[model samples]
Target: MLCVVYKSPNKEGAYLYLERRDDFRQVPTALLDTFGKPQLITVLNLAKREHLAQIDIHKLQAALKTQGFYLQLPPPPENLLAQHKASLQNDKG
Candidate 1:
């Protein structure tokens, strides 16, 4: 299923990952403005690092508001494999 992933605009806006494509399509421009792009990037990195299936946008936003940072989800399995291959090559060098 396709999902809508976006950043919130409010102060320390958190990353939002909507399961429904419609929700993603419906994101208000004003909301995006409130959540700065940088903050959204941070959240995306976190979700990617942690390997989260579905992150709670509201919780992430709240954490960002209070802590200024959040844990990243782990990289996807494919990415992990690629990283491992790169590391092996580097070690050979």
Candidate 2:
């Protein structure tokens, strides 16, 4: 199936994949408010197996099938800096 991907301007690294590029009317108002204006990213073909960086093809397919869209949120930071800082503080103490 072909899917249209939209990137959220308000939230960095957030994406919305939908069946129809122009059909966003079904998306909830609350979600839209948080999502902000969606910028057209790319159109992709969803096969059984494919190379997707942040999302699983099966999961994406299921979401698009059930909810008419799939939302991808950014992954959390590694937080190595915080751990390093804590270790430094412990050493100082």
Q: What would the TM-scores of all predictions be?
A: 0.26, 0.81
lDDT of 2 by residue, 1-93 (tens): 999999999999999899998688768889989999899998988763486987888889988888888889999988999999999999999
- Measured by C-alpha RMSD in angstroms, how accurate is candidate 1? 11.9
- Candidate 1 local lDDT, residue 33: 59
- Clashing residue pairs for model 2: none
- lDDT tens readout by residue for model 1, 1-88: 2233555444432555544332333345665455455232321443444334555655655545554333334344467888999999
The C-alpha stretches of model 1 lying farther than 4 A from their native spots are: 1-10, 19-24, 38-93
> Among these predicted structures, which one has the highest TM-score?
2
**Model 2: what TM-score?**
0.81
Q: What is the Å distance of residue 44 in model 2 from its true position?
A: 0.4
On the 0 to 100 scale, the lDDT of residue 79 in model 1 is: 79
